[model samples]
Target: MAWWKLHKRDKPGSPTGAGGAVLASAAIITRDQVRSVVGKGQEWQAQAWDFYRTVSELKSGVRWAANGCSRARLYIGRVDPDGSSSPTPVDAQAEDLSPDLVARLLAPLEELAGGQLGQSEMLRRFSVHLDIPGESYLVGFDDPTSGDRRWLVCSPSEVTSAGGGGTIRVQLPESQSARVELSLDDCTLIRLWRPDDEYAYLPDSPLNGLQDPLRELRGLTSHVLATVDSRLAGAGMGVMSDDVVPASPQQTDGANPVHSDPVTAALIEAMAASLRDRDSASALVPLLLRVPGSVKDKFEWHSFATELDSNLLPLREAAIKRLAIGLDMPPEVLTGLADTNHWNAWIISDDSIKLHLEPKLGLIAEALTDRYFRPAWEALGVPDPEAWACWYDTSDLKQRPNRAPEAAEAHARGAISDAAYLRELGFSAEDMPDEDEQRRRLLIQLATTNPQLAPAALEALGVRLPNIGQGAATDAVRAPVEISRVAPAVEAPARNEPPALPIAASAVLDDGWRMACLDLAARRALARAGNWLLSRSGRSRRGELAHVPVHEVHMHLSPDQADLAQMLDGAYRDFHAATPGETDLHAAVDLYVRRLLLTGIAHERGLLAGHLAAAGCDRAAA
Candidate 1:
């Protein structure tokens, strides 16, 4: 005996199984028993199974619909505490945890849905809740040996709700045929459904509600498929009927005559075989049908082909539209029939996202927030878990045909802030400048353009400046005064005092004296012009010419002083054209004055020295 035949056969009812036959029989009996148990709730369960099977058959289309509906981003936000029901930015800690939690949830979902799945897959799996009454999942460790847990979305068939929806029993076939019964409170599951009054145990799915339309769609699709097969099979090909040739050419005898001679028949067979053998590598090869020479002129080949009508297209499209209506999805999305114009496309996309996708996303988001986010945040010690909620940010996903121009107009009209406008344009918070920073920049710009307003701006900002003088001086001084005064004052006579010198004596100045006085005035004006040039140079060198005030060097100069002032201004500008760094304007003016005074003194000294030298030379000659 072989080793395989050594074991003894066990009885049917016995637990012990030594033979493979007993094990095989037990497996068969167990499957049959499971089926028998499942068959007890025949009517509703059978309908549910039918829907599941139909969805499976249309898996690609169903998946596409689900994905199109789920292509929106979800974010965590804080619920307003004042009962406004408005969302606010999440608290710092919750905001920090949101991305990690989102990533953690997404990673496993992608793994479960295969790595190609994204936010769309997460919502698609949750969409099963829309197809079935509800879905239950086992939230357990990803690795049974490890403590880390994840949600495994299971089929409705795998879970059996019992005790009038109090406790649910889950049978894990992969885990030693384990059966676990859990109370509603203990079960960690998310249920997504549309509310209605019809069913008591579970809500009705879109699948159930739209069953008739779906059936019609299925029938239409079958008809289209059949039509395509028929066209491919025979409609496009020409068939030579027995009566296609004139009756005069056919034999009148009751006995059937051969349709064609051996060579023609062989050619016809070859053509038919070529057409039928579609899988053959040479199916596309050109074929030639030859007729015998004696009968060729007498016979004519008459070909007939069934006409393919365009009428079915509209009917099939109408059926698809009905199916789309039933699914609560846009027809364009499901059928891939789109409007050519950008405006129409945008309108359709916007309507679908707002009217269809958002509501569905909201259901999923609420469920996940309650079942997944709350517990996770609580575990991480986040505060006020009740106030925190998850929501979909469909703003980015929505098509905005007029957003650019609208945002620009709103910004120009001061209807929205710069940051808000940028956000509408899809800029993130981190990418925009803060309001306070923007205000500060604006103030700086205003001050640069109008330096006289700098003091007022600083005062508004609550800056305190040192008092120039006490009460009297504060009243007297109305503007900022320069530290150095370049212009000489011509003081008026006191009220009661007489002129310093007799009016006649003051007027009786010599021509030489008047010329000398005019010369001094000219030098003074030149010095002032030099000072203005130096100030300009300083401002330019500091790279703050826009910020610096323009000094009017010729302000106090008389009409007679204009020529020398303009000449000196031009000369000074030309001299310092290439000079770098800030020039000391006051210093430049003082240096010019000292040089002018010293030049006169030097001339007088030179005259004295020349006279002394002449006297010494005379003494030496004597």
Candidate 2:
């Protein structure tokens, strides 16, 4: 369905557009019917699974880890022979794919088993099981022979090896048991990084290291709950003298019997009973203990000694940090939201994705490719399943600043060229016109300066003058080059276009040395201004220039484009600053025109800034 699939080269006898179809195949069928497993297989690992289940259910670090991973995007990508060799809006779409085969390959993953769970949500639950038990199982039954199949995530409890290598028995949800072929023929094992490389069956969970801290936390939570309950029940026990007997058997308002001997219990219980349905806004509740002799003098009440669990929250935070570290995520990402700012948050997330999440996602992708995708392809007559497989896009996790406006401003200032500007926006500059506008504008300025010139004179300078009533305006850039009645540029237009100047105006300027000096000065100033044209090449013998490195463009520059354009502009304005004011009338007019023509020629942006370095002096004539 993707656009890049169109360029497939048709080979004789090959199926129509089948080259890019293997990876793009939507549904994979397998002969070994899969049975979705529910498990309780490892009794030795029960405690760890319990830890995972408890924390995952509660508002804890495991929940944070799950939420962080749920944003991942999973898609199948494969290289096409006709893949895009140019820039694409999204960097993830490396190439194009074939639709027919790709659709079949992709069919099962669209709904991802049972029409509810998508790939991301599946991975989320999968990650939780993996992180908690250090091992997770999946049984995908894509029975080409059957009408039903389920890609199921299994618990560490109900699934286990069935006495033999590469065989697993799953306790199905239907309360039936089935033996699964274990080379991912029917079931797959997705596990964490185990230090014991030899024993793939038993992997280590982060909870193993967190056991002591968690146990202490549970104890702390229990103690606090007990303290609160004690407080709620009259805040303490009441001690009464034993000799004091009740006048009569006492009863609460609800007819519950109260032992008359313990007047404190009678009083407190009576108080509690009266307030059960009382108006919450009213602070008063009356209790009649009905104790015989002066009970207040005989009875004494003492509140239990209790201390606050101030370290509970701090300890919980420490536990979350350990979990984050175990999961290879930034601690700040887990529980440090208040401390994160907009600027550093993006950086932290980018680092977390690159360093931690990438490898985990890779493992899951590989498992899916091998156990699910490849087999389905094999059934569908795909000879090479490796060509197309599952891969993840963490683009959602990629946070970056948009510098579009800044890039536009810089390009307008000529600190960057059109190609550089296009590259800034992830666009290709390949088809842009090669013509220079700056040089074209210079030609227009020269011809418009004097309306007195003949039609033939305009042609002599290679100027395409506008129609009769169409007046034009142009800025005359002046540079101090010596002049002797050389009022027009002749012999060559000195641009990418073919020659246009006429032969009648071909008289060389008397002072050639002054024109050369002006050209040399302009080049020097431009070089000082960062030799911007050279940098615009975006590369040099030093490997890459300031332009080649997109991320590094704003970091460093020698003179840069803005400075080059600005300095070259100043050089033009100075060219005619030396036109003598003490000349005779005719000679002064000739000198002004001559210098104007020279300065305009110098300001030309085409063919090496009016061909100053190579042929500017040679191209200019009277």
Candidate 3:
């Protein structure tokens, strides 16, 4: 019989030897038969019920894996004719297809998976495709002018493959009686089965390998719950057994026999009622029964107690560990074990992403590239539609161990630029300071150290310099004048009147002031020589110092000697040019004495020529 004719009558209680029975008996079933059995018929309904129940039961681990795997970032890319692939530009366009430009283009496909379906829900549904045969979604575009050209992603339960498996028919959600037929070219189908010849149509799942562990986990959990319930059932209830003997009959007067007295019986009944009320009100409290002294010895009391074995803890842990092993995740991640340190946690996370998530993400990327992106591109009249593809950015999915120290060392060793170092530390261009800003900061540092370059640096950076006159005015306003005003002015003493000095100068008198002039010149020459030596030695290594020429030292000192002479001449002129009222005699004498002391020290230490000669010895040896 024809496949279509078989599907029309394929019901649970259909006539034997008819179309339905013939199709069921056949070993090789067509797509129409598979769909009729697994899509909309009683079998489909039963499978759907089982599918949902399994999902609900495995909600914790299943959701964890699905959400974690799908949280990866998605992006579009294109393959070059030379076989290289690069991410497509965010603003890329191709005729009427601007996939990146229109945010809503795939919104329905990602979020509107019929009714309240969204990207996460869609991912979860796709993740379960392995549990079922496959996943199917009906695709439809919204109005282009409305800027809502999103494809509708309907549930797979509503879709059924046609006879040849090349097309599908969707039973509308609004009215299950109405059906819309579409070719496979217009739908997005993700099969979890192998594409090879063998087992091509059979569904496969990672969870299949975890069945034994999952069963053990369920059994252990049920045992624990049952144990707890049993303990609770008997908690605080006093012993009640028929093994105890009854109390011996008590002797009493005829009028006061225990069973015959109404007042005594009434009092006993009231006390029993009160005890029952108290026991019921507080279940934790144990009820006590009192007997006559004579009868107490004849009766025995017992206690009912329940204690759960502590060995069950290890069993529970073992079950959980088995589950984690099956899932290929860290035991701590699923069981909340807190013994792991940061380093171990990081290693586990990295391993989980590499082993579990990467393969799944690769499959998803391939599916999106082949089934969705390629078709969309082709519809837009794009040239070489096979060149374009979609991918996920899994770079941020795993936690990278701290590498700041290594990157800093590399930067210090000049192995990487500042930008490259930043990138290694997971920073983008936007996170780093711009070249202009860095340059401005460098200029500011240079100006701070040199002072001479302050104006030029400030001008280059468009920074206005403070006016010199304004600074002078502010300083003058803050100057101290109260001390000078409070003290009386003292006139200079006579020069020959035995000048009162802080330190007595050498009493050696000269017929001319030639000695004083020579002393001043000597001090100035020593100062000039020290400054010249320091400047000439600029960054010279100890080994290189021996290679310097003696002539260079002599040449270096000549210009400094000339400068010293000019400074000495200027000082002499300033001293001689000063008016008597402007200069104090004691101040002039003190300055001459200090210069004399500096000259004596220089002559005694032989710093006048010996210092330069010693430095030039290295050069002389060379």
Choose the strongest candidate by TM-score. 2
lDDT by residue for model 2 (1-622), tens: 2111111222356332233233211112122212332243344357666555555422355555566667877766663546552112122443454556656656545635453345666777766765666666655544434635555666666555554334555555655554343434443333223322455434555665666655555666666555443333333445455544433434556575565557666555544542553443211322222334555677656644444455666766676566556554566655567767877778877887777677667767765665455545655655465567677777767836665666786897789888877866778877554556555554455455433333545676575766754223211113222443233332334424533333321322234565454444444443333343343433353255534332122223433322323324343334345533322221222232233233332222232223332222333442
Give candidate 2 regions above 4 Å deviation: 1-38, 43-59, 77-117, 141-150, 154-198, 232-250, 253-256, 267-302, 307-329, 333-339, 401-622
452: Cα error in model 3, Å: 6.5
Cα lDDT computed for each candidate against the true fold: 0.46, 0.48, 0.45
lDDT of 1 by residue, 5-64 (tens): 111123356543221222111111122233232213324435655655664333444565
1-622: candidate 3 lDDT, tens digit per residue: 3221221222356442122222111122224344543354234334433533543334555556666665666655555557554556333544556555344333323433342334545555555443332333424433234634334434446666665655666565457586666543433333323122344333335454555656665666666555443322333223333443333334456864555454344334333443456345333333333444444345444444334345667876776667666553445566775777876777777777777766666666665555445445544445665655566666666746776766776787799888878877989878887888889888876565333466798888788876676443332123321112122122222323433321112222221253344344444444444444544443443234445442123223333322332232223333334333322332332233223222222231122122222222111222
Report model 1's TM-score to 2 decimal places.
0.44
Per-prediction TM-score:
0.44, 0.50, 0.48
477: Cα error in model 2, Å: 12
User: Total clashes, candidate 2?
Assistant: 31
Q: Model 2: which ten-residue window has the lowest total lDDT? A: 24-33
Better structure of 1 and 2 per lDDT: 2
**Candidate 3, overall lDDT?**
0.45
lDDT of 1 at 156: 51
Preferred candidate (lDDT higher): 1 or 3? 1
